[model samples]
Target: MTTAIDSLLQILDLETLEHNLFRGRSPQVGWQRVFGGQVIGQALVAASRTVVEDRQVHSLHGYFMRPGDPSVPIIYEVDRIRDGGSFTTRRVVAVQHGQAIFSMSASFKVPEEGFDHQIGMPEVPMPEDLPSEKEMAARMPDTVPENIRKYWERERPIELRPVDLTHYFSSKALPPKQYVWVRASSALPDDPRIHQCVLAYASDMTLLDTSMFPHGKSVFLPEIQAASLDHAMWFHRPFRADEWLLYAEDSPSAYGALGMNRGLLYNRDGVLVASTAQEGLIRRKKPRE
Candidate 1:
C-alpha cells in the first residue's frame, strides 16, 4: 500500500524529458493551487539530478511568479550555471500553461570540514509530551473551522506537533512566533538527497501562519488570501526527515500586504540542520455586494 510519503516521493521523482528538462505532476488533492513547497522540492530535485552525487545542496533561493495550476504537469528547465571544483550552481524554472510559475537557484558543494557554530535550539516540550495532531483534532472537532478541519484531519506524509495550541483556537492578536515538531510519518529510504528534498517540501508548511498571528488572522480564513511569494533555505548539516525535528518559526514583520517569516530546523539532538526564510502575500480580500 502506498502511503502519503510514498506519494510525495513519487511527486518529487520528476520524469526526465531530455537533458536539462524534467516534468512533474501535482497530486490531485482538490487544491486549487499547487503547494509552494512541492514546486521548491521538485525544482531542487531537478537541479540535483544534473550534479554529481559527491556534491550536496547547501542552499537555494526561489521566487514564486504565479500560482501553479494543479491540473497540468509542470516542466522544470534546469540551467547548469556553473560547475566549479568545490561548488556547483544550477537554476531551474517551473512552467505550466506556457507560463513560468516559479524559478529557483541552488548551490551544491562537496562535503568538507568547516568552522561551524549555530545558535542553540530553544527549549520546548518534547514531541512525546505534546498532543498528536490527530488527538488535538479529535478533541476540538467543533472548534476548528470547517476548511481548516478538512485539511488537518486528512492523513499527511509529514506530521506536525505544535508547541502551543492556542494559535489554532483563538483569534486574539499575539506574538509573531511559533514552534512545532515536524517529521515524516513513515520511514523513508536512507538517501540524504531524499531527506533534504523532503525537508524542503515540509519547510513551507506553517511558517506563514506566524505572520498572521499579529493580526489575529489565519491563512485558512476565506477573507484572507495567502500565498508564498518567495522562499530561501540553507542546509547547515545532515539530518533525517523521518526523525523528530523542532521547527522554530517567527515573523518579524508584515506590511503592504506581505509577511516575512523565518524558520530554523533542529534535530532531536538539538543540532541546527537547516534554516529558511520566506515572504508571502497575506492580503485580505475585500467583500463585495
Candidate 2:
C-alpha cells in the first residue's frame, strides 16, 4: 500500500559526521533530481539535532538554489547562528556536487505565553464520505500518469480528501482556492516534535498546485514541469498532526515561470494551528509541431 512518495518521506534520516556536518541520502523518484520536501524534512531533522528538547521549531524558511542529484548523497552543514536562552536559530546548507543546492533557516523557541486566536475550520466532507486520492485516480487512471503512479501507490502519511476532485482534474477554469482535510495516517506519538516534522513533510504535497487551479493544470501534466523553489512555514500552536485538520490553500500570483501559494491549517476543533507559504516553478512546455 505504501507508495514511492511515502518511502521518500522515510529516507530523511540524518547521520552526524561532525559537530555541524551531517550526511543524508535520497532515493531517486524518477526524473525529479529530488523532491523538495525531502530536503526540507532532512534539513529540519539535522537542525533539530543541535537544539534542546525544550525548544520546538516555530518557523522554517528555505530556498532551492538548484536541482539535486539523487545519484549522490547530500551533505548538510549547519551553522549555529544564535543560541539564546529562549530561542535558537540554525542555518542549513544542503550540498551536492560540491555546490549548495538547498539552504534553510530554522528558528526554535521555548514555550511562552502569548495571546491566542485562530480562524475556524471550514465545514467539509469527512474522509469517510469522500474518496481517497487513489480511488479518485482509479476513476480516471489516465490522470494519474505512469511516471507518477508509483507515488500514488505509496503509503500516504497524511489523509487527504479533496473537496472537489472533478474540478481538480477537469480542463475547466475554476477558482484558485482548494480545501482538503489532512491528518497523519496513523495516530502519532505524544511528542510534539514528531507531529511538527510530519506536518512539515505533508505540507509540501499539494500546496503549490493551488496556483494552477485557475489555469486548469494538473500537477501530473506531462507537458508542464513543476518544481518547488522556496518554502516557509510557521507554527501557531501545539497541535496533533494525527487528528483531522483542514488545509485551505490559494494561489495569489503566477508569472515568469513562478507560482506562489499560501495555506492555513486548522485543527478539527477549528483552531488554526499553522500557516505555510511556498513558491515554485510552473513552466509549461511549448506545443510540439
Candidate 3:
C-alpha cells in the first residue's frame, strides 16, 4: 500500500512539461481546495530543479493570489531571474485554469562559512514525552471534536505533537504562542533538497491558527474562515524533515480580518533551521439570512 508519505513524494515529483515549465497535481483527498503547503513545496521543487546542486535554497517569499483548484493540475512556470557568483534567484508562478493562483521568489546560495549566532530554543517537553494522536484520542476521547478526530484519523505525511491541548478542550482565551513538534511520518531520502521541500510542505501545518488563540477561537470553528495570504521563510541550517523538529510560533497581532504569525523551527538538537512569517485571512463568515 502506498503510504501518505509516499504519495507526498510522488506529488512533489513534478512532470516536466517543457523548459522552465512543470506540472503538479494535488492529492484527491476530498479537500475543497489545494493545500497551500503543497503548492509551496512543488513550486520550490520546480525552482530547485533549475538550480545547480551545490546551491541550496536559503530564502523564499510567496503570495497566494487565489484559492487553488484541486480538481485540475497546477502549472508551474519558472523564471530564471539571476545567477550571481554566490546567489541564484528564481521566480515561480503557479497557474490553474490559465489564472495565477500563487507566485513566489526564491533565492539559492552556495554553502559558505559565515558569522552565525542564534537565539536559544525554548525549553519544552520533547516528542518522547508527548503523546501521539492515537494516545491523545484515547486520553481525551470525550473532548476531541468529531471533525477534528476525523481529520486526524486520516493518514498524514507529517506527524504533529503539540505541547498543549488546553485550547482544544476549552474555549477560554489564551496566549498567542504555541509549540509543536513535527516531522515526516516516515524516513525520507538523504537528499537535502527533498528535505527542504518536505519541510516547506510541513510549515503550513498548525500555524495561522496561532492568530486565533487570543480570540478563544480556532481554524476549526465553523464560523471562522481561514486562508494563508502571504508566506516568507529563511533557511538558516540544514536539517532532516524526517526527524523531530520544534515549531515555536507566535502571533503578534490580528486586525481588520488579518492575522500575522511567525515561527522558528529548530531541530532536535536545538539548532534553528528555518524561520517563517505568514499573514492570513481570518475573517468570520456571514451567517445565513
Give the per-residue lDDT digits (tens) of candidate 1, residues 1-289: 9899999999999999999999999999998999999999999999999999999999999999999999999999999999999999999999998999999999999999879899999999999999888788788899987666667789899999999977777899989999999999899999899999999999999999999998889987889999999999999999999999999999999999999999999999999999999999999999998
lDDT of each model, Cα atoms only?
0.95, 0.83, 0.95
| TM value for model 2 | 0.90
Relative to the true structure, candidate 1 reaches a TM of 0.99
| Model 1 clashing-pair count | 0
Model 3 agreement with the true structure over 14-114: per-residue lDDT tens digits: 99999999999999989999999999999999999999999999999999999998899999999999999999999999999889999999999999898
Over the stretch 4-110, how does candidate 2's per-residue lDDT look in tens digits? 43554466567889998999897754545877877888889889888999999999999999998888889999999999989999999999999999999999999
The residue-level lDDT of candidate 1 at 251 comes to 96
Write out the backbone clash pairs for model 3: none
Error of 1 at 70 (Å): 0.9
Residue pairs in steric clash, candidate 2?
A: 2-154, 2-155, 3-153, 3-154, 3-155
The C-alpha RMSD in Å for every predicted model, in order, reads 0.8, 2.6, 0.7
Q: In candidate 1, what residue range of length 10 has the lowest lDDT sum?
A: 144-153
After aligning candidate 3 to the native by TM-score, how far in Å is the CA of 251 from where it should be? 0.3
